[model samples]
Target: MTISGSCFCGAVTYKIEGKLRDARSCHCSMCRKAFSAQASAYALVEQSEFRWLSGEKLLTNYESKHGAGLQFCSKCGSTLCGTYKGMIHGVTLGCVDGNPDIALDRHIFVGSKALWETVPEGVPQYEELPPENA
Candidate 1:
């Protein structure tokens, strides 16, 4: 299955060629500030299976002091994706075109979550990134 998405102004578009998995919500302070939301939802995709169909030139990347870099549409300022020191890309689900046929498996960085934010019940919560085996 393939999942597709674009920025608010449709300037940037992307396609995920394979199945998406390990979806999660991040309540980290950096995420909240970067996304301008209480939390950010994302799904993991292999770099080989992901493609930027358009607007590659319009993507502007910002690397925080913590070494976390995010890519967003320069025209619309929409958060598109993020990359760590790995081959996987974390695609923000909010910009996705449709239902990704996945569910949030866990909540990460809850320890740094906003005081006013309340995470949903029944979902696994972690004070930081999940264990490698999780």
Candidate 2:
């Protein structure tokens, strides 16, 4: 399935030609701050299936000390995707156009989630990074 996405100002756009995977919600302080929300909803995509359709030069990226990177549209400050070692690692669900066929498989860093934010019941929750990621 082909999925398309763009930044809030429409200055940046991307497309994913394959299915998304490892969908998850991250409630870590870093994530909450990055997304400016209770948590960040994301889905992974293979580099081979991901491509920037336009406004590549208008994107800015910030890399965490842990080596994870979040790329945003410089024009609108819209988070678009995550990167690892310079390759696309995942797409931020918020910027995804329409509805993509995916759901949160896990919630990570709940231990650091906002005190007022309550994770819903069901699925799986991790105090920190999941074992597979830790």
Candidate 3:
């Protein structure tokens, strides 16, 4: 299925051409700080399958520590999505056009989650990272 999404100011839009790989919430400090929210939820999309449909120039990028990059809209400063090491791409769940038929599979970096937060029910939670190394 093809999924579409846009930034908060509608300055950037994109489309993904297949089912996502893994959909989950991330509670890592970087995610929290980047989003300024309790957590961030995203779905993985292959670099080749993801396409920028509009406003390419409006997309701005930030390189956080460890060389990880977060992509957002320059106009509204909305945290639209991100790419890791310039390879795989992921889109924030909130930016998707409608409800994606997916569920939060796990919580990553639970060890770095805010002290006041509690893990949501039913999802497998990981202390530092996903089980897979790469």
**Model 2: lowest-lDDT 10 consecutive positions:** 82-91
- Runs in model 1 deviating more than 4 A are 85-88
Q: Candidate 1's residue-wise lDDT over 9-47, tens digit each?
A: 998999998878899999998899999999999988888
Kindly provide the TM-score of model 1 when superposed on the true structure, using C-alpha atoms: 0.93
Residue 16 lDDT, candidate 3, scale 0-100: 86
* Per-model lDDT: 0.89, 0.93, 0.84
Residue-by-residue lDDT tens digits, candidate 2, 85-117? 777899999899998999999999999999999
lDDT of 3: 0.84
Better of 2 and 3 by lDDT: 2
lDDT of 3 by residue, 1-134 (tens): 88889988888998888877688888988899998987899988888888889988987888866777888888998877777775547889999988667778888888889999988878888888776943
Q: Pick the candidate with the highest TM-score.
A: 2
> Which residues of candidate 3, in runs, are more than 4 Å off?
none
Error of 3 at 119 (Å): 1.1
Q: Better model by TM-score, 2 or 3?
A: 2
